[model samples]
Target: MEIKVSLIISVFNGEKYLRECLDSVIRQTLKEIEVICLNDGSTDKSKEILAEYSKDSRFKIINQENIGLGASRNKGMELAKGEYIAFLDADDWLVDNALETAYNEAKNKNTDITMFQMINYKENTGEEKKNDWFNLDKFDKRFKDTVFNYQQTKEFLFHLSVSACQKIYKRSYLERINAKFPEGIYFEDAPFFFNIWLRANRISIIKEYLYYRRSHENSITAKCDEKFFDVIPSGEEFFKIFVETGNYEIYKEELINFAINAYRLTLNSITEDAVEEFYKRSKRQFKKIVNSPYIEDFKKYMSKGNQDTFNNVLNSKDYEEFKKLNVNSKGNF
Candidate 1:
């Protein structure tokens, strides 16, 4: 039997880039694939485009209220009938033969998760220009002996930021761990990928750059809002889970570095309403981190940028220091 893959996408106000994204998927060299587009209450032509695409046999559209990316993904999971699952952002796309290459390799190797490289393209770029934006150098020898563990995976993530688009996962593994993207949240890919990496065994890697990620201005990562701070609580939840289950002392440094960097990012993006709440929550969280029994290990990864942010949080009174922090400023670092 031929292997089947489901390409799931969640969209909101994606009319501008919807067609291009869909076109890339339809043109993939991987023939036995299904395209499931979840319309999460887009107030634009996004729904119209989905309707138009529904005419294709492989296209399936689900209209849903604005339940956020997590819920949309979970809904897609429920509707998907494929053995292997792949995620794609509405604004991003895959290169030709991307899925065909990854799928064949993963199946042949009998691996649980398979990953590749991605190229980020700008909006105005033409087809040829878009393909040239990424660094395509392959890294075969370096990662050859790297074994998979929760700690090794965490360290690797420090270098390669967790992106949902760069990998294809098995549906059985996702189901085994009950790994659904959390509903009503931003940066929702965090807990999901963290869980997947730790759970996956027999993983395979491809050095090819197969995914094209578009860094659009209106993308979710571009919105530095109050909801951004929610990442702290969500991250804390992941840390606790990892520690309790793995008993791995190795993630301390990376965890601290991740937390500190995230703190700076959150503080720098705060609005008036987000300032007081962010200060209180983050201050408490940082204190917990610094006072933890493993403080010394955590300090090993204390980046200069994190230390500055922490000091600012400690010395300031009632959002004053936070107000002094740059919000969308140039060369603030």
Candidate 2:
């Protein structure tokens, strides 16, 4: 059978759980699919595990030096022959029917992107946090098993976690929009997926949680290094893209909210001495974004909750209060 989907997993010394990850993909019901595993210069037995999986014709292995996650996934996208492409982290696994369920809906609706839900999988206890954005109560009734065009889905895009794994993109659609992850950046998904989401006319959402995002200490988001600040730049790159292309107001509320969140994360993750400088820099950015030519339009279009946040970001006293609220919510950024 011709390959209908190409699932890419980028690895960097992930031998410990690599077998389970590969097994999940190999056992997928979507038979017409290829598992593309990119070995990012692993110093461990990751290469060996990949070699064992290479025995299966459907497994495509690309062993390269550590070029980071963005570059590795970019290579996989360039080499993918399938009509649709999806991502899976080396440390994470699929839900057996993930590709099948996602592909069927995407192909049937001719969607540019099909997004499913992922539960945080706990490695030690094998328990999953089922309370997620995908939970039925959390989603609008109209969004369930539905297809949304660009304008219809614009607001929903902001709620997306920016994780490439929970989404499947049409190969041609990605090429048309030049949707690419920024190499060497820690938060490449913020800019990359936002760009893609803007260009997507048809995006489908599945209520079913078809992916498992493992929660482990080794994950990048779990770390609080200098790299944690990369999300600020990543968000800015796309914020400019929206403004330069005259698409700012169309997603102004989202862009502004994302900026505020980025500012909060930066403040929480940076050293004490760096906080003031970061705050000043972010304040300037906030001003630039909020001083939009369509600020009125943004206010009109923004949801109530967002409007309050937007107002607070612009106000010194209220913004300080907002910071206090987020004081205890550090470390996860």
Candidate 3:
């Protein structure tokens, strides 16, 4: 019984949404799917829930000490015997029949990766928002059905999704590139995904929102971890991979823009108590970028506002005043 799609789910104390998440995978129309779950030392009843469903046979569960999300996914990938791979967070669920469509498209097109969209669902208010990583508006109508890597240059990089969960990856392609998520880091997907997109020669974009990415205050996405400024390391890896692949000079502009946004995102989200320390660390990161070869070229490609902000930060090193400006704009500049 060969697996067509190995859906890897990484969980840690995710009891509240665990049942619904498992239900979605178990009910997927794609019968050849295998759900590989990593129970990363969850103290909650998550392990109990997993045991309840282990009889499904297709569900493979790994109970391990608390490893971060990246390591959990990596362990599941090692155990996966599927031809295609998909990722699902423990708190997120998939659309019924979504697997069938994505799998068929990947197989039929022989794509290295099948990219899809997600519905950003507000758990509290039930508000839905678009999470189209492909930015379909930029798609040339003639190439809609074509393999993107063949039709577009790294131009498609402009809308690349840093999150890995929304896409279906060909197992062989991943193995060939020796691509594995870096473990023990928050937001590990950014660098892992950047490398995948660089190595993926053929990608198919499906416009459907096949996954529901739930939003909640408890989610660490909006929190700054004093334990680790994962983005600084991730962003550095982002740039290193590009330069190593000889794409730094070619896609320099888009890459720089992505870096700026990445930096700003983390800097803006830091908790007030941790701001001083985080700012020092972030300042070093910015200086590294500014000193990179051909970095002066980066300023020209930056959006006017971003350019000015970077200049101000480089000159004044005043994250405090920058915070004041953001406060004035109601926190989104």
Candidate 4:
């Protein structure tokens, strides 16, 4: 059978929902698809679950030591035989027609990337909420049912969702760009997603929520630790990519806004123990932003609240003073 889509899943001790994830792929309407499961040193019943699913011809499992999600995904991409590639977390499941619909849309438009929407599933309350961030029309009406390149949509660059799992890429396009996730990082998706879209000549959108992103305490995003600092390097990598590609001059304001938003999110999520170090790192990053050639543009583009936050970062001598400055303010801005 010809493989139209190769769904790559990196499993690492995801036994709780591994079966459901595998089942969703097995039940995909698109039968001409290959499921690549990278068992990244799963010690639990995950291996047995994968073994059970490996009975199917389309399901191939690669058992290897834990090399982190980014590296495992890179390995899966290297071995993928399908025309297009998609990623799914082992704890997340997909809608039955996800692959089929995305594949049809991608083929029909001859797009380098096909982006879609995702629903967040809360493990505690079983609540499902559609994340509107993926709704292209919300950013601009012209984006609806449109096939366009990065330059055409550059104005809304920062507004776009960076979740790699919410999109599918043409295998040839990925190979041409030598696209690979940043290994040994927690927020690798940001760089990978931005790099692809920036270089993609043609991209399409599927507004349908095709993927279910599980929200649980065990997930990496829920934890507040050193890994949260990974967002800093991830942001730097993408910013550097923009500069190297000569797009920085065109989207400096957007890129700076993206960095500010990322820094704020990190500040809000990180543990108290990480405050001092994170503050230092963020202050360094903000210093670069203020000292850049586009400092005037950054000032004009920044909101009053963000300006205050920026000033606090630059003026505060220590994290203690920084905390005190925003102790009563909402969002710590």
Candidate 5:
């Protein structure tokens, strides 16, 4: 039997790169797939370009008001009619064999999700950097590793921060848990990863680079803002479940590594709320790692800027001191 996959690509005024993204999808080596494009109120030629592709049976378009990327993805998930689901951003393109590789891996492992590596590209200079999406070095792929339950998967959940566009998921798993992207948040992928890993029975990792993440001017990931840090609330809520369940005790090391990477990313963005929120979470989790027991190896990778912020939060009497100075903050944490 042929495997059918629904590829959800959410667009919001992505006129500049929409054609190239669609071309990449339509040229996928795995031809048994449908491209579901959700136009989230694009006030550009994105809608016109998408309309042209609606003529193809393999392509479907849903025109809706500006509901944000998360809601647009949820809307696509609702209408998806495939056994497997893959998410692609309108501004990014994928490798030709990505879908075939991910789907085959999931089937062979009997896993709920399969993730692969990605390539990050600079839109202006055309410079490229490869990203190991899962840090699969932790797993022995030569053998069949049986992850009995969701808790076993949390060991790998932190890696989901790498990127959502790199993975393909089983529709039944998502349907069983009613999984959908959270609406109106910048980091919609974060909560989805947390919740899915909590419910997913098995996850397989593919180390080969398959997704290309284009860093363009208007891309949300390329831009920074206060509202972007709105994801902290959801992060806190998800982390609470992680700590309470303690299903991830074995992966504390990975969690700290994840936190450090997250900490650095937030700091580099120079957003006050992102900085403050990371400070708060790291402070709360400090006791857990104070003894250098779980994540000693990652200490070297910590940036001077991050270390400074961490120290400031640890020693400073007031959080408002730095917030008052950030141009983006205008006095808020």
Candidate 6:
């Protein structure tokens, strides 16, 4: 059977929600899909749960030592055999028609990429909310139901969500571009996302919310540990893509805005114990930006508020001084 979509689920100690995740795949309305589960050294019943689902001929499980989500995804891409590739976190599940709808849209439109909406599901409260980031209404009405590229939607570039799970890519397109997640990083999606969207020739969107993203304390996103620092290197790699592709100068302003916003969010989220180190590294990154050849452009495009924060970060002698300045400027610590 020709596989229309290869759904890769990266698992690591996700036993609690493993069944639901696997069940959703097996029950997908599209039967011509392959489920490739990368078990990244899960110590819990995750392996056993995968074994149970492996009975389905469409399901395949590959076991390996813990290499993190990014590497596992890359490995899954290598093993995938389908016209299109999709991703699913082991802790998340899909609506019954996700693959069917996304695959049909891509195939019919002959698009290089197809994106859909995601619903955030809170584990503790069982609250479900539509993720506004994926809302396509923000784009111009003319772009709807038609194939387009980043250049056409460049004005709303930063508005696009970076979550890999929210989209599907043509296997040939990904291979042609050598697309792969950045291994050993917490924000791998950022680099992978920027690379694809910036280069894709044809992209489409499905307004339906087909994926459910679970929110829990144990998730990497909820933690504020050493891994949070990974954002620095990730952001560096992200900007490098634009430079290598000669799109840096064209999208410089939007890119800088993205970096500033990302840094600010990270600063606010870092744990107290790690905040100092994060602040130091962030300051170094901002200094590099300030020293770049595009400093004038940065100054021209950056908002007054962001400029003040950037200067404060560079002028402060240390994290303490930065904190004091920040508290005074924002009226809070």
Model 4 C-alpha lDDT per residue in residues 1-333, reported as the tens digit of each score: 889999999999999999999999988999999999999998898999999999998999999999999999999999999999999999999999999999999999999999988888999999996655755444456777889888888766777788999899999999999999999888999999888988998998887889999999999887887787888889889988898788887887778777777777677678888867888988998888778876797788766556667778788899888878867555464
How do these models rank on TM-score, best leading?
Answer: 6, 4, 3, 1, 2, 5
Q: Pick the candidate with the highest lDDT.
A: 6
TM-score to native of every candidate shown: 0.84, 0.81, 0.89, 0.91, 0.75, 0.95
User: Pick by TM-score: which candidate is best?
Assistant: 6
Which ranges of candidate 5 are over 4 A from the true structure? 1-3, 134-162, 240-268, 271-333
Model 2, residue 102: what's the lDDT? Answer: 91
| Model 2 stretches astray by more than 4 angstroms | 134-138, 269-333
Residue 55, candidate 2: Cα error in Å is: 0.6
How does residue 238 of candidate 1 score in lDDT? 65
lDDT of each: 0.75, 0.78, 0.79, 0.87, 0.70, 0.88
- Candidate 2 has an lDDT of 0.78
TM-score of 4: 0.91
Instruction: Tell me the TM-score of model 6.
Output: 0.95
Encode model 2's per-residue lDDT on 1-333: one tens digit a residue: 788999999999998889989999988999999888999999999999999999999999999989999999999999898989999998888899999999999999999998888888877788888655544233477777778765675545566567888788889999887778888888888788778877778988888889888888788766565666576678768777787667786677667666556665566677665565555555566677567565666566655444544454556544356465444333223
- Residue 1 alpha-carbon offset, candidate 3, angstroms: 0.8
> What is the total number of backbone clashes in candidate 3?
0
- Where in model 6 is the C-alpha error above 4 Å? 330-333
Off by over 4 Å in 4: 137-141, 284-302, 327-332
Residue 247, candidate 4: C-alpha displacement in angstroms: 1.2
Per residue, candidate 5 scores C-alpha lDDT tens digits across 240-282 of 5456556445554555445555544564574654556655654
Model 5, residue 175: what's the lDDT? 92
Model 3 lDDT, full chain set = 0.79
User: Can you give the lDDT of residue 149 in candidate 2?
Assistant: 67
What tens digits encode model 1's per-residue C-alpha lDDT throughout 1-333? 353898899999999989989999889999899888999999999999999999988999999889888899999988887878899988888888998987887777776788777877766554333232133233346555233434444435545546777888777878888887767767777777776776676676777778888876787676677777788877876676567657346666777777678777776676767767888888787778678876676656677667667656665675765557533233244
